[model samples]
Target: MTTATPYDAMFSGVIGQDYEMLKLLAPLAVEMSRLVGATVSQHPKTDDKPLSVVELGGGTGITTLSILAATDAIQLLSVDNEPVMQGQAQKKLQAWQAQGKLAFCLDDALSALQQLANGSVDVVASAYTLHNFTNGYRQQVISEIFRVLKPAGQFVNGDRYALDDIDQHTRTTQTEVGRYFRILTAANKLDLLEHWMVHLFSDESENHIMRESLALQQLAAAGFAGIHLSNRSEVNALVTAYKPR
Candidate 1:
C-alpha cells in the first residue's frame, strides 16, 4: 500500500469540507496587516509605495480577504502548492486580481520566497500553515521570510503550538481535539468529524507542532527582532517578528 503524504492525509479536500474552520485565521490576518501597515509607516521609503504582502499557504483566500480589507494600497500575493485550494481562492479573488490588488501563485512557499529579491517584500504572513512543517524545516522557512522582507518588515503567523512539558502538551492536544469535536458536532457533520479526529489527533510526523518558546527562539536566531506572541490559546497562537532596520 502507498503511504499517505501529509497533504494527502490532512490537507487534501480540507477547503471543501471545513472552510469555516479556516475562517478562524481571518482575525489573525487582520492583525498581521495592521502590523505590516504600522511597520511600513515607520519607514519613509516604503510608506507611500504600495505594500507588497506575500502570504504563504493561502488556503481558500479567507485570510487574503481579511488582509485586503484591513489595509489599503497593498499588492498581495497568495502562494500555495495545492491546486484545489488555489482554485477556490482564485474564484473568490478574481475581482481583486483584475483590479491589480491581488495575485495567486501555485508554488511552494519556500521556493517562491527564495526567488524574491532581498528586501522586496513588506510583510510575510501565514495562518495555520507553518505547523505543517517539521521543526527544522520550519526554521529554514522562517529564515527565508527574514531574507525577503524589507527593513522593519514583519512576519506574522497564526498556527498551532506544542508545549514544552509533555503532560501539558498532551492536555492541550486533548482540549484542541475536543474543541474540534464540538465544532464538527454542532455543524451536524459527524462523518467529517471522524476524519478530522484521526487527522488532527494522530501522532503523525507531519503534525509536529513546535513549542511556542522554541519557535520564538528560532525567529530570533534568524535575526528577527521584536519577536512577540500577539495572541495565544492552549494550542493556537499568533506570533509576529520584525526584521530590524
Candidate 2:
C-alpha cells in the first residue's frame, strides 16, 4: 500500500515554474493572508448566519486556507479562471468544501464579481493576483467589489504595489531582477528565469502595475472608507478598506 503524498508537499510540484518564481513573495503572502483572517474575525456573524466571503483568485488554496482557518462560520466562494490552478486548490481544500464551508466559481474575477448580488458578501479578498490585470480591468473589479459588499464590508488585498517614485521603482526592479538572475542561474533554471523576467516586466508595465498611491486613491474613489496600507515588504503590500455603513 502506498501512502498519499501530503498536499503541502505536492503543492510546489503541481504549480511548476510559478512555484519557483513566486516563492519569493511567499513571506508577503503569509502576512496578507493572516491579515485577511484577522480582519474577517472582527466582523461578528449576523443573526447566526455564516459570514460570506468572496476570494478574488484562489491560487492553489494558499489564501483560502488562511481564511478558512480563521473561522468555521465562514462561507467562502473562491473565484479563479485558470482550471489547473483551481483544480489544485480544490484538491487541497476538499475537506473545507465537504464541510460546506467553501465553494468555487471557475470564472474571471470581474465576471464573477458582476454575478454576485449587490450588498451580498461580507468580505472581498485577494492575494498576489490583482496586479497582473490591466488598470482598466482592475478598476472595474474594484467597483464591483464595492458594489457586492454589504455595508461596512471589507476588502483586503496582499499584492505587489509598485512604488510611487519612478526612480525608486526603477532601482528596486533592477535589484530584484539581478537577484532573480543570480538565484535562477545557480539553480540552472535559466528557462524559468526568462519566463519570470518577462512576467516581471509585464507586472511593471504602465498598463499593468498599480502604484501604491494610486491603489489607495482608487479604493477611496470607489467609496470605501478606512482605506489604508496595513503592511508592506518591498513592493508587496497588504491594503485594507471598507464600505461605510
CA lDDT of each prediction against the hidden true structure: 0.72, 0.81
lDDT for model 1, please.
0.72
What TM-score would every model get versus the actual structure? Answer: 0.82, 0.88
> Where does model 2 exceed 4 Å of error?
1-21, 24-26
Candidate 1 local lDDT, 57-148, one digit each (tens): 88777677767766668898999888777788898888889999898888788888888999889888777778777677687788899999
Candidate 1: TM-score?
Answer: 0.82
RMSD (CA, Å), each prediction: 3.7, 6.6
Instruction: In angstroms, give how far residue 20 of model 1 lies from its true place.
Output: 2.7
